[model samples]
Target: METRDFELLIGRNIIEKYRADRHRPAVFALAGLEWDLLDEVWPPTYSPGGELFAGRIPFDRMSSFLEMGCGTGIMSVLAARAGVERVLGLDINPAAVRNTELNARRHAVADRVTARESDLYSAVGPDERFDGIYWNPPFLNAPEDSVDTSIWDETMFDPEYAKLRRFLAEGRELLTPRGKAYLWFGEALGNPALVADLAEETGYDLGVLAKTEMAEIPEALADAFPADLVGGDSEDGEDAAWHLHLLELRPRQA
Candidate 1:
């Protein structure tokens, strides 16, 4: 599929799903833990990315952690439960911040997990640092002139990759000397080349930690786009199901 067509189809599907399910609050279990998702907060039940990333976090290696764009504090709470000493979850959406707080308290990790409304690193203290930082960013490049009119829109779109650029640049300053940062990106749904370019430009070496296939596209979405376009062998002969990439970012070796 053409890039524009693919983006439009994905955007439409995201909006439709959000509209259909935004007001519903529910509890979901992932990796042996329960998370309470609030209305308007992105739900892990809809996308497996959060659970996937949370499971891969090296909690044993980190004393302090920061989770950017923490929708419902799933990873933050899990990290604390796994014995990370301190976990801070940040989100630009007020609803998400509150949802994270709710889940933190729900899991009895309220003392260890802190949620704040922040646009990337804006709310992070300059003198504070974390042993690990991670984000499942709004990776889609929204069409020009697009304005985020809703929290769902902010969750799904990042116009011109602006937020991503800042994330890579600013997040570096908040990491301890031995700390590492991770980004969970969907190669099929995001611009990977741009991600590489931004990582290099921001003085980081980007590498893959792990990856998994999405496996099945929703029947509704499959019908909207060409069958071959949505999922099939890629130009490199790799299955398109292998889309979600858990990427690792480290400071460039001097």
Candidate 2:
């Protein structure tokens, strides 16, 4: 699908809509591949804000890597281009897992990268580890409407910020000493301070790589970026939610 086909989410709210042609199939362009993903749930696109944050990090050559929460496999493809020998993209959703696999083939990196349906590190071998890792965790803090169904957050809905904290804690075991992790975070939920605390509590060194304020949303994506994703935007005569912060992470080895 064309970039114009994607929509936006604006204002500070828990959930929004992506009125794209859901039936046409979902695809994302990453590192040259426009791989088709299962859109039974919404598929993620690289927005200007997200891309800008992603562009800031100076990824270094690494022996092997892992990308948790690899939605649409966009970041994973970028890691592959950065010269990682092998990369594993892991997520909890089956649809996302399938999408990631297709995207890897689209970039002709299927052999170099793999996608797995895993709840955190459940599927990973206890002995498995990595030199470098990348993650764009679900960092939004919004109250869920009901605990009934955990809607796929590909569209950036507000849910308890549980996944990120868990990753910060458990991800340490997966890192190889001298290893580094490239983590991108959207500060819509006011998470900079919280992330810092988590980093310290988890015993990892923190580094702020890139950050930008949520200025304005495009006409199209006014409903996709989600108010909770970009600090909320109002139509007129009022201010929207304000947010900003993005960065990478390192596993402390002292």
**For each candidate, what is the lDDT?**
0.79, 0.62
- The TM-scores of all predictions, comma-separated, are 0.89, 0.75
Give the range of the ten consecutive residues with the poorest summed lDDT in model 1.
218-227
What is the C-alpha RMSD, rounded to one decimal, of candidate 1? 2.6
Number of the predicted model whose lDDT against the real structure is largest: 1
Which digits, one per residue and each the tens of the lDDT, describe model 1 over residues 1-254? 55755675677676676666544558878767777877777766666664566767678989999999999888888889889999999998898999899988988989999989987788988787998888888766767565455677777788778888888888888888988888889877788788999999999998888887767764334543455556577778977564788888898866
* Candidate 1 steric clashes: 0
Cα error, candidate 2, residue 39 (Å) = 1.1
* Candidate 1 runs further than 4 Å off: 22-25, 218-239
